[model samples]
Target: MNPQALSPRAKRRRRLQQRQTVIYGLLIAGLAVAAAFAYLVFSGTVPSPWTRPITMPEKIETSETMECPPEGAYSVAFGSVKANVFNSSNQQGIAVSVAGTLREYGVTVAEVGNWPKFLRTDGQLQAGKAGIVAAYTLQQVFPTMQVMIDDREDASVDVILGHTYGEQSLIKSGDFPAGVEIVPPAECVPEEEPTEDELNDGGEDLVPEDEETEAPSDGEEDAEA
Candidate 1:
């Protein structure tokens, strides 16, 4: 039947129905989009933009002692030792004051800042492969601090103070490094690599993660073809 032949009342009713259909379609589409977004947020597959990332430390274990001295030398003097102080705690300006106290012992304070990446309870003494002994030297003062290994390619160690940090040197009354000495360069011990099982079960992947940086299937498809 032609709409031109319809009564005026019928025409008005027909137009109203078409308008209702269009409105219902839009509402359904909107509902679908909202449902999809909610799934992405709750499924843990996609992070919501408004949510602050909760980075509760899943790993913070003491690194194995590699027994390495400074880059080439076996030992270093207290005055010549290099170190950096970091405050990760909520305390204000604690690192700077600690650095000053560190300088009094003739230790070189390279840099000081607040590092929030690795949060701790007491403190952490971090050193690279070449700075093991340097870290050990700093550990003398802060003996209770835990040791962590970093990837820095230098002999400078870092001391990250945590929430309960009120540490001071144990040698407060001595000649400050009473008998510090300079060790000549010798054959340095290499860091032992962690096995695959250790990588899968240990605290943090650390060095193993570097070996697995590339995706596991990058060249596998082509090789299989």
Candidate 2:
């Protein structure tokens, strides 16, 4: 059984044996890894123990917001314009009071719980992706009140103008208070080329030529002498 004396067939057999041993070892290792992964999947738990009771953030509740009407007595102006506004929507109970004019027809709507976003194309509050949380309850009720844009520097008074909620195209700038006007962003206009008349002629400026001083006539000088 000397190593040097082994035949070619024996050498080939020994090599094959070593290769099979390596393959068997790899196969066992693979099976063990698969088993471990399967266990993780079926355990019905996250890897982290702390994640077991998944925490959800607490939801914020809507609150009341107050805004004054554009005009009239301070006492009479504020309050819910519509009674049903409180009952129907998610709005929080809100009572408006006149704080005074903001700018022209603009008046401050103080104590707004939820910030109002202006929607020019439509008067109604646009539905937010997460849905709107109503923050103000109505003290007065008017289903067909107008919406108007407040010209005030502060954003508190940009109310919808014109027709009420139900009317088709109810919101119009014209419906706003007497002094309030909608100022849309200026649109780009095409630049016009200057006309030929506008160009300077013969080195003379577009401005009127200064009057040239005339040399006194020789005859007039002689007459004076």
Candidate 3:
């Protein structure tokens, strides 16, 4: 018997099988599409820092360190509160951005100066102090920047951010964008108030009483006699 001339029942069964195959394929394709849609919706609707690709940190870590005077530097610490930011030197100590928007991400070092072994804690870079090494890219938002402390108080912070065009003696080139500036901390001293005596003396002459009297005593001697 010719295969093309199959029995009616055989042809009908073959058609049913083909229809079932197409239906199953369509079902599988639909399921894949739905899964992809669900993933995008969940990941997009939820706000997360991980959403933005951290390209620099993912590639390699870059860093640099410098010694700077707290004065002429930007304030990283205002009173008891510290701005957000951190830094590291070698395997010890972490630095911080003294005063700026970046302060929101400053570092708090549990260790004194051992950066690699230091511990960083803050709400911004919750990745821990280890994120210092991970911050390989410095995007410039300020025309000038500085990291400074309020006093000689130790644990003032390990690093500061500022521009160098001023009297700043330090310059951080690598790991920083070209022409990126590092400003020194500004002076933080309470304004001096004039004392009561000082205020009263403002317009007064400083002539001695004896000098003001001139030679009156010598002339008065004759009147008394």
Top-lDDT structure, candidate number: 1
Model 3: per-residue Cα lDDT over 1-225, one tens digit each: 685999889989989999999999999999999787778778786354356643211112222222233223222222222223333323212232223323333323332211232323211111212221122112122223322222232232333221222223223322332322333224322224676678668676566566775555644665475
Ranking by TM-score: 1, 2, 3
Task: Return the TM-score for each candidate structure.
Answer: 0.47, 0.21, 0.20
Q: What is the lDDT of candidate 3?
A: 0.35
Question: lDDT by residue for model 2 over 1-225, one digit each (tens)?
Answer: 897898999999999999999999999999999788768867864263434654321232222222223222122222222111111122233212111221222332433222233223322221111211110111112223322222222222222321222333322223222222222212312223575566765555564457655668766664465
Clashes of each: 0, 23, 39
Q: Give the Å error, residue 137, model 2.
A: 47
Stretches off by above 4 angstroms in model 1 are 1-75, 167-171, 175-225
Q: What overall lDDT goes with each candidate model? A: 0.70, 0.32, 0.35
Candidate 1: residue 107 lDDT (0-100): 89
199 Cα displacement, candidate 1 (Å): 19
Whole-model alpha-carbon lDDT for candidate 2: 0.32
Worst 10 residues of 3 by lDDT: 121-130
> Which pairs clash inside model 1?
none
